[model samples]
Target: MDAAVSLLRRAEAAIPSGRGASALFAMLRPDDDPQSWRSTLNNDGAPYQIAVTDAGADASVRLIVDPFRLGRDEADRVGRNLAAFDRIAHRCSSAAAARCRRFMAALAPSFEEGCERRSGDIWLAALPGAAGVGIYVTARGRAPQIQCTRLIAAAGLDHHRAAIAAIHAYGAVEAYSIQGSRCDDLAINIYWKPRGGTPLPPAINFEPPALSPGSPPTALARAPLGAMTLCSTFAVLGSGRGSKIDLCNHCLGLDLAASLEILGRFCDLSPAFVRGAGDMLAGEDAEIAFLGVRVRPSGDRAYLYLKPAASACQSVPHLVEGATCR
Candidate 1:
C-alpha cells in the first residue's frame, strides 16, 4: 500500500469514523487499489479532500470523503471503513456525540428528498476533539427548495436558535462545520465561497473584494488568483451572541513557483519532497490544478486538493474531468 493509504488504514483501524471535514477516513478493502481513490480524495472541485496535518509518528490525516463508492457492497464497505474513524485521536462519548450522530441520521431523508442535485458537501475539520457534520443552508437556483437550516430544523438541531439565526445571517457562505466532541461547543464554520453545478476544472482567477480604505496589504485583506475564490472564506465559531470569528482568510490556488512564495510566508514547508503536501503527482508534468492554502492568525494552512491527471484518457471520469451535477 502507498504510505498515505497505509497511514489512512492505520488510522482507520486505530478507531472508527471521523472529525468534521478532514478526519473522515476509512479502511480500504483488499481488492481496492488505493491509488485509484487518491484522485477522488484530493479533488477540490468535488469538495472531497484528504488533508494531512503535522508530520512523522504524530502526523494525523483527515479527509471529508465522498460516499459514492462504485461497487454493490460499497455501502457496507463504506460503513465498515467509516467506522474506523470514530476514535482516531480522540473519542466522543458524551451525549453530544450521540446527539450529533442522531442529527446526521435525521438529515439523510431530507438530503434524498431534495429536488435539487448539489454535489455532496461532506465537511471534515482537523481542529482536534471536534467531530460533526455540516451542510450548505442557502437557497440556490430557480425556486430552490432544500436548504441546510431547514434540514437542521427538521432534524431538531434548530433548538440552538442561535445557530439557526447565525445561518440566516451568513446565507452566502459555502460550507459549515459543527464541533461535536466538545459537548458544549456549538460552533459552526461557514466556507465563504460557493461551488455548484457539477465539477468545473479550476481556472486561475483571483477576484478580491474591495477592501476598506485603511485595509492592509495581507491575505486577509486581499486575495490571490486561481485560488478557491476571491470572496473571503470564513469560519463562524459560535452562534448569535456567542458567535465570533474563529479563522478567516482567502484560500489561494497557485502554480508551483507561486505556491512556494506564499507557502514560506505561512509555514516552513521545504520546497522539495515535503511529506503530507497536497500536491500528489506521479509524473513530473502533472500540472497542479490547485495548490490550496489558507492564511490565518494561528498560521497558514494548506490542502493538496485536486487529483493528478490520469493517462491521457478522453475522460478519466473524475470530477475535474468534467461531469454534470447528478
Candidate 2:
C-alpha cells in the first residue's frame, strides 16, 4: 500500500501540467467508489475522504484532501487535465457521455445562434474530477469567462447555481450527472435561461425510436460513417476476354428495369454497367433486355458472397473481380 501510494505520486508528477487532474482526482479517492466519491465531493464542495483498513493488523488510516485552497498553478493543471478527460470519456459508451453528445448535437444550431448573438466562444470540457461535465463561454478579450461545472460537489450548490445562471444568461444548455458510491441514484440537471433573458433557440428535436416494453433502451446510434450499406444484387458484364471494370457495390444491384428507372431519375446511365445477360437479351429480343444481376453482401461485419451469374457459363469472361471475392 505504501509502495502503491508512492507509485501514484510518481505517476502524478510525470503527467503534463494540464493532463493530470483526472489522475490526481482518482488518487485522492483511491479505493473509493468512483461514482460515489465524485458525487459526494461535488455535492459537499469538500475534500475527498480516503479510508484505508487492515483487518489483520487492526490498523486504518483516514485522510481528507481539502479542495478550497489549491495553488493557482495546480488548479490550472487540474483544469486542463479535466478537459482532456472529458474528450476521452466521450469515446466511451457511458450513459452520461451519450446524453451529453445527444444534447450537444441537438442544440448545435442554437449554440451557433447564441455564439453569434453574444459574440462569444462556447467551449465544452469533461470534468471527470467533478464527476460530471462543464461548459464555458467567453467573449473575445473577456477575462474570467462565464463557466458552469455541473455534477460538482453537492456542498457547492451556491457555486453550482451561480455557474448555471451564468451559462443560461449566455444562452447555453447543459446536462450532467452525479452518482457516487454512497448514492445509487443518478442525479441529472439541465439548465437554461428564462424568457426575459437572452433565450436559447428551441432545442432541435431528434427523438430516437422507443424500445418495446420488455426491452432495454436501444444503444445510442453509432457515428455516421461507422456503417455502410452494400447492394445484394449485381450482374457481371464482359466478353470472353479480360474487359475488367469495377463498380461500387451499391451499383451492382440494379436490374435492367431498375437501371432504366435510375437512368430516368439521373438522366445518365453511363455510371451503370450493362449486365452480361443484357447482351444476350440485346441480341435475342431488342424490346426485352435481360440484365444479369449479381447478388452478394459486403461489409465489415460479415462474409457474404454470391456466385457471379456469369460463373455458371464456363465460356464467360472475367469482367469485374473483387479482391475479396478471389
Top candidate on lDDT is 1
Task: Give candidate 2's whole-model lDDT.
Answer: 0.26
lDDT of candidate 2 over 93-186, digit per residue (tens):
3764544443333322233333233211223333222343433222222221232332222213342344334444443332222221112222
How do all models score by TM-score?
A: 0.48, 0.20
Candidate 1 lDDT, 170-260, residue by residue in tens: 3344333444454454444333333434332222122222222553435433553223431222222233222222112114334445544
Which ten contiguous residues of candidate 1 have the minimum total lDDT?
241-250
Model 2 residue 127 CA deviation (Å) reads 4.1
Q: How does model 2 score by TM-score?
A: 0.20
lDDT agreement of model 1 with the native: 0.35
| Backbone N/Cα/C clashes per model | 21, 17
